[model samples]
Target chain A: MGIIDGKTICQVALVVKDLDKTVEEYAKLFGVPKPEAFRVPEESVAHTQFKGAPSKTRARLAVFDLGQVVLEITEPDEEPSSWKDFLEKNGDGIHHIAFMTDDRDAAVKYFEKNDMPVRHYGEYEGGNYTVFDSKEKLGTFVQVKYEPKK
Target chain B: MGIIDGKTICQVALVVKDLDKTVEEYAKLFGVPKPEAFRVPEESVAHTQFKGAPSKTRARLAVFDLGQVVLEITEPDEEPSSWKDFLEKNGDGIHHIAFMTDDRDAAVKYFEKNDMPVRHYGEYEGGNYTVFDSKEKLGTFVQVKYEPKK
Candidate 1:
């Protein structure tokens, strides 16, 4: 199977300058409840990298639903992340499109073989997930939204 | 009844430099078929406005499904269009997030009241649609993807 099997565009991630206000605006835009904002617990993500370096970057996250695909809004907090990069360069806009799959390792390898290299590797729910450097190849980055086996 | 009524983000539209190449690249990325390319025939749309004036612009379109939301890739002709504006400014990335609705007029009015003014308006398939000027308010533009009565 290809890198896309069992995977779907499950999220559209945006880098916002003001997390709370953006969340409120999106809630009004979607007629949905204001997303509860929180910082990603550092312990939950492991082996994280930014620009190919080991990263201890922190960011605030706000999540909401748009059908099955979630909208992930991020605001970098003192961390040099792609979120900060997007905000500094583009002000605010979509940063990445994420695909959810159980077979993230295989998907990562397949994409790597296809010339998209993994920029970041992380553990969520004790499982593996990766961010592929697809900006040059696809005009935007891609995330392997995986939850590790419990 | 808010600006969003039975409306969900059902599409993410991108303005690309090359229609055929982008479609082929996306098909390979998703393991989906190459979407048939098309142009939004001028006669198919009525009362269209671009940059606050009546428009006779033409653009190519290629669409495919990405889970519940559709991915629409656009290549504007020589006409001055938002697509061309995006290409000149950002090269290629998401241009707008479209929320599907049946009540086009009310939705447009609601957003206008909420400070998101209409940037563009037109009819496709005899249905009304609008792009809201939300780049300042929401970081990215928003579209009222409505199917209006003929």
Candidate 2:
């Protein structure tokens, strides 16, 4: 038994240059009825960090619930964000693959043991998450997320 | 209704430099039991075409069934392959998004009407597929595929 798996993967986030444009583009391409776009308020993610430093990077976001997994399209602000870095270097493409971990500590330990280091750590709502700098070895970063307890 | 819906999308193909390495890395990261690698024979795709010409682009392929949609890892051969073009130009990342189409002809026409031209097309196992060159506007190629008739 392991921590992350196909079932544990919650979403695949993409870094795009234009949030609203891609949202419309996807809606038309996928023939979806109405795929709405929202914003991941930087204020809400007050505990944000970029490149291991305290920074307030914000993004306009949209989520498409593709049954088993969600597809997140993120358009980062002009701020120097990891998402912006990806969009500038790789253009609009996959940025990170995320897993919902019930136990964040165990997941972090496991990832470190596998030679994947957590580059940036942040908090959204009451939950904590870490971004693994796995792009070089895995071609994309890996994120492990936890939900705030009610 | 749109030609292809979000639900129609079956897989997101990634062009990697090393298939074996990526497969192993994913298996370990996702904590999967074991994900085996398979090679797509060049001759089998006799009808393959890249940039509007006959081609023999093969790849070491592996499918990670991520429940709702599958993640296809492809390492194109050194030959002049679209996959190779993507890898050479963009490095390892998402190459295209594929939707299983019911009618290949109509699907191709629909995409063409939307300004997304089919750049590569091929047939295998009695099924047909087309790759639309929508990377500029949409950030990635879109593929339409059909299954063999019963």
Candidate 3:
């Protein structure tokens, strides 16, 4: 089976310059109310790591559940996270398309074996995520999130 | 109701530097056989227009139907099309997220009224599509396709 055998795309995230303005525009486009924007928690809580080193990367985020997939809008700080890197290199555009994997470790290893190693990784309340440097092949980074069974 | 009152996103398109290589990688990533690549027909057949002028823009395209949303990879030629412009300005990345709209003309009018005018438009075999310059606020162009009932 392919590393990501499931076909469900969980999320599509974009890095923008202005969080509020982008959120408003999306809200209007989708004909929905603007979801509240929240900042990524501090490094102490988020434990974000970039390229194997702990980094204090944070971003203002707003999410819209567009039924089929979640749409994320982010304005990242001047840190070393993947979102920040994308914003600086490509300006405001899609950063990643995320998929949920049952075995994060195995999936990451498969990508590494294919020469697309992990670029950034972090933890949330229920799950941990890895960002692969798959842009060379995929034209965009692929983020795999794993929420292990409790 | 929002301009796009639909929650189902039909497609997400990306611009790539090499269509063959990218399609191969994506096929492996999704554990599927490589879909054949096809060149967009000439302007006479496609009737492509960019910024209100007839333009001969062509691209090699490969598509993967990932259930919930279709993934389209395009490599544009040295022509004046939306795909070409995005490739020149942003390298290779996500170009547009498209939705099916029942009333495409009205949706285009709404976007234009909001200062996001149509950047490119063209006809396919069964439908016509319009791309909006919504990147300033939405971080990526939004394309709406209209296929009228016969």
Candidate 4:
């Protein structure tokens, strides 16, 4: 049987308040090209695995070059977004660390089988993403996914 | 004058409810071995740093076998530890992602010059640390520091 292994965190997603300013700061600080910004309208919110239940969440996303890993920041328009909650409650910090996986289902299963608590926000054509609530286990949210790419 | 380059995330610290249990989980799930475990009771809290903080906030730590880096988990037996607050508010999420800097003062100055809001958590003998309030910048707190193990 093939063995299972935990992969290294390759990306961190930060929920920000303002998208344009955020991207601008990163570009200047890292001295890298400005990140291409995109808007995920309210309709796409349900499909993407975000915090809380499926609801309207307008998001502006940008990715900054960080060598091997990229820092992704998303500013949501509604409900203060999960990023705001984290910032206000705990102060600004690393939002979520993502580990790449070949098979998200298998990855989720592996963690579940190990008695890890897992929560799935939702799944869309892009991918089926789930959050391994590692807060109890690791003090971080580990996101895993395996599906078609956009 | 020698100019410093970019800052890179050096270490991620966490506060765990149980040191032994936390170490065991990572070792078993990630195939990483537990590094030597020790108690640093002299700290305001029962602590041990990833490699040992020269100032304070030293935490009980277990370095991953791969040496990808160290994971410092602090537990407070006396005063209310910052680690405890992290766990309570975020529920086992990333407490802080530390970015290594050649000149912590310079980085802070750069952000300050930009009118970016900052919360200086002060410095340790081992390194200087501060949380750049990036809620409007990156939607997360960027922890910057200058740490060199002696």
lDDT of 1: 0.76
Q: What is the DockQ of candidate 4?
A: 0.30
lDDT of each residue in A7-95, candidate 2, tens digit only: 66677787878777777877776667556776555655657777767767767788886665678888888776778878888888888
Model 1 chain B scores worst on lDDT over the 10 consecutive residues at B1-10
lDDT tens per residue, model 3, B68-96: 78899999988889998888888889999
Measured with C-alpha atoms, the lDDT of residue B99 in candidate 1 is: 83
Q: State TM-scores per candidate.
A: 0.91, 0.90, 0.96, 0.68
Question: Candidate 4, residue A42: CA error in Å?
Answer: 8.6
Encode model 2's per-residue lDDT on B67-101: one tens digit a residue.
66688888988767789898899888888877787
Off by over 4 Å in 4: A1-7, A40-58, A77-93, A114-118, A121-128, A147-150, B1-7, B38-57, B65-72, B76-91, B111-138, B147-150
Find the candidate with the highest lDDT and give its number: 3
From the highest DockQ down, the ranking of the candidates is: 3, 2, 1, 4
Compute the lDDT for candidate 2.
0.77
- Those runs of model 3 whose alpha carbons end farther than 4 Å from true positions after fitting are none
Q: How much RMSD separates candidate 2 from the native structure?
A: 2.2
Q: Model 2: which residue pairs collide? A: none
Q: Looking at every candidate separately, what fraction of the true A–B Cα contacts under 8 Å does it contain?
A: 0.44, 0.51, 0.74, 0.40
Clashes of each: 1, 0, 1, 8
Once fitted onto the true fold, the runs of candidate 2 whose alpha carbons sit more than 4 angstroms away are A126-128, B44-46
Docking class of 4: acceptable
Question: Which of the predicted structures, 1 or 3, would earn the higher TM-score when compared with the native?
Answer: 3
What TM-score does the predicted chain A of each candidate obtain versus native chain A? 0.86, 0.86, 0.96, 0.71
